[model samples]
Target: MLTRLDLMAGAFRAGAALALSEPEIRGLGRLVRQGDVCFDIGAAYGMYTYPLAALVGPGGQVHSFEPLPNPFRLLAAGRRASGAERIRVNNAALGPAPGRELMTLPYRFGLPIHGWAHLRTGQRRPGRPISFSSTRTLKVEVRGVDEYCEDHGIDRVAFMKVDVEGFEARVLEGAARTIDSHRPSLLLEIEDRHLDKYGMTSADLADPLRERGYLMYAWHRGRWARVNSVTTARRNYLFAAQGGL
Candidate 1:
């Protein structure tokens, strides 16, 4: 939860509105439809939520998940300000399993970049140009996407965007049923460094998608190319289901 002081400071310090860049928005528009439901996992300040709501339209709904308080507050504020009623923001994390988990919010010079917060038990790589300290932590609720959909009576999801730092695999795991049944298009960030923190590699993150017959593509030089493997570098990959939406 965010305190009054944090909300005030964040609203002013947040500066420009957080939304997907032009290329990303265009890329997403290709996958989602006007009446489709979508999910924006690790949604830091509605970067994709507002845009998704617009893409999906009022008849559609965009469920955004953001665990950290600072960004969660901003996310909710942005949703309200945008008047995107179809966008529902959730202040919780999602993982393979539903339970309480510890999330780390790193601070540089005592300021937090809400987007950088991640869920990991292990420490980051040693010695960077600037030292980042995990000065704050919050125990957040984790839910499975399959369970969430079932409870909410959501039969289909046109697209699901996952960017949970390094736990992208876990998010996919929780959404197994949804993937198998609904065949939603997946746009998830593949960052090997974050996966390494949890003893996972980039390839491990793509296993389920591969098993589900998802054709993987990475954006290269402003265009997407089919990829059999992803590197440790930070990038988003689009997984299109075979013979499905």
Candidate 2:
């Protein structure tokens, strides 16, 4: 009884809701325990934040960062509505330093794709000239992880989920001290196409994480398989410390 247009609209409407994949939810459950300190970097709309808050329970806390104004509003509202008191929402971008930076936002039908917004960095220029008719840009506040953690007196971070699109390296660079101190397990999203937009290669991603003593793995088939390098083939990666969680 539904037309193609109707179905398409329905899908978009459904996407507006905050939800997480079963595998990621399972992974979080396995990695997080109650009372743990966790972070949701690039948390779009509380998809992972809600679940992480629930997993951490009353004693634990989950700090969620979302830069885009639109999504940040939604995330904050969701946090209040969910009544997940353990989740803290921050409305600033995380990078290697504290300042302001430009962010590129891809659009569709003149509307921004909230989940695809990414920070722009000077480290690498796009390999090829890239442009989209619907694309637009904005400036966002950027904060360093080390400074934020130190200022907040948060010394322990049990788990982190980073989906900064292609700026993962920058985010990690800012968090080096925190990474060194906490050695928290991370769920990172690495896509070659996205990285290429910034003239960066997948190696740029694997190198820093490796330097921090993280071994990458992909949840392939039914098991966690070791990944030696970042290829165009894979996206979501789970990085664990050598010692274990």
lDDT at 69, model 1: 85
Error of 1 at 108 (Å): 0.9
* Tens digit of per-residue lDDT, candidate 2, span 34-120: 899998899887667877777787799999999998989998987776666788999998889999899888887777877667777
RMSD of each: 6.4, 6.6
Q: Write the per-residue lDDT of candidate 1 for residues 171-217, one digit (tens) a residue.
A: 88889889988889899888775676677777888876788789897
For each candidate in turn, the TM-score is: 0.84, 0.85
Q: What is the C-alpha local distance difference test score of each model?
A: 0.76, 0.78
Model 2 is weakest, by summed lDDT over 10 consecutive residues, at 4-13
TM-score, predicted candidate 1 vs. hidden true structure = 0.84
Question: In candidate 1, how many clashes are counted?
Answer: 0
Best by lDDT: 2
Sequence-dependent TM-score of model 2: 0.85
